[model samples]
Target: MDNVSSVIEFTLSGFDEILDYKLTFFCLTLLCYCVIIMVNVVVVVTIAMDRNLYEPMYIFICNLCINGLFGTAGFYPKFLLDLLSHHWGISYTGCLLQGLVIYTSVCSDICFLAVMAYDRLMAICRPLEHSSVMTRQRVAQLVCFSWLAPLGLLSASTIFTSRLKLCGSNIKKLYCANWMVAKLSCAATNWVTSTTPGNVIAYVIILFYIFLGVFIFCSYVQLTRCCFKSLANRGKFMKTCVPHLLALFNISIASLFDAMYMRYGSSDFPQSFQNLLALEIIIGPPLFNPLIYGLTLSQIRNQVLHKYLQNK
Candidate 1:
């Protein structure tokens, strides 16, 4: 410990390649961030204002949009600043906070989507009990749990990262990642041990993915059976289920790329490709969800468009 220096700030090296075109990247990133905010806000506001939209599904969709905004907040501003500035460094404390927001928000995405899958399964496969089971108070509880659980767990993980005596100052990531920071720890070899919170989170999340996957699959199989039983159910599935599937597919693919790159990525990979993987999960869902959900869900689509035209 006497011979080693702890890292005080982390230099975000991920932006170096793209920083050559800083002016252009800054503008484009700003524009993208603005669009993400506008679309997600519209969806959330539309759902909130319309009394007709006060249903379990709409409420959950509103949360999804809100979460998208929340997650991106941790990335876009810092990213934009880095894009325009000569310095791209974040303090040690700041990095931990950013990592907390980014990681929990992404995991929260999975949680909300799982909640949505449950909502659809109930509506389709168990229509009679759906109303009773998915009461307003109940949905509120589910929402609270979905958000709080990840926040709580990751906060613990962040504490572990903070206690680490990091020997390195450079994080090749655009944003601080739990694993990346852990790798910089003076005790890097055991940072991922079973005793470590980071390792526990990794195991828990993998199990969470498998459980949600099976649950969604079974829910869909039942949904398919019901859809075949009646034309009305089939039509409903086509409208509602398709977009949910699209969102799930989009998030799943994006998360996979991010996880693979985070754990296995190295400088040997082209910086451009590394950049793509880092930004893909962060960019794809927040942008993809509102558009897909807004276009596919008729009431939301109509309400959003009506408000847009009225303002124009």
Candidate 2:
């Protein structure tokens, strides 16, 4: 690193393991991306076109689908091209922007899920006040919180990453991780120096997720408590809350995989296995979540079934 400051681009070797299987990987990846796009689009369109489905839950589901598209676009396009082309590198600025899109999308998802949990809690626990409490203004605030919180948090993190004097240009797994970039700091820069900004903000993000997980858990507990009190509450829980719990379980598993691997990934692991773990967070959730919401929510299922999904 004679001139470490001059490093302009980072090489992504996540695809290296599958070079011989590029055709198979590309086809599978492309098919997955296509289905994600198609399902999300259908769900969004169903929710938007049907005024009857304009409740807070549907509104949140719509935002979730949009964010799914937002998060996946950050990865799949560049990844698909990398599979075809010779080079597998992204410029520094591009890397920052990609990290920004993917991360904001990821964090915002948890925000939306938390908001949905609160919405469910209110609808079940305080049924009489649910409509008044979840006014248009309140819905707007929660939606904005979902998008803006992640944008603000990660923007600060990106600034810290951009200021580092990096000694390396290779990112072992796919896509740019701000922490991984920070991990490449020059010999003079200690990985966990007191001067490091990431240490503080990294804890902030961890705390944010922990707080949200607890919030969601508490909400569901309250929901479960109320469920036993009435047959109607039990029905509502079965219809709405159960799907949300399933979605949360899926996202938690995906995020857990990425977080654990990011913190403790081993060089001894096969590259293909490493790449699969890296992709777990971004790939599966986007494709599956909309399906979870769409198929489970009766209003959405009915609308879609009556329209495009019905017999010819």
Q: Judged by lDDT, which candidate is best?
A: 2
Cα lDDT of model 1 by residue, 125-147, tens digit: 78899999999899999899779
> Alpha-carbon error at 264 in model 1, in Å?
3.2
lDDT of 1 at 135: 99
Tens digits of per-residue lDDT, candidate 2, 187-234, equal 435567733576788789889889999999999999999999999999
Q: Candidate 1 clashing pairs? A: none
At residue 298, candidate 2 shows an lDDT of 88
Off by over 4 Å in 1: 1-5, 192-197
Residue 167, model 1, lDDT: 75
Give the top-scoring candidate (TM-score): 2
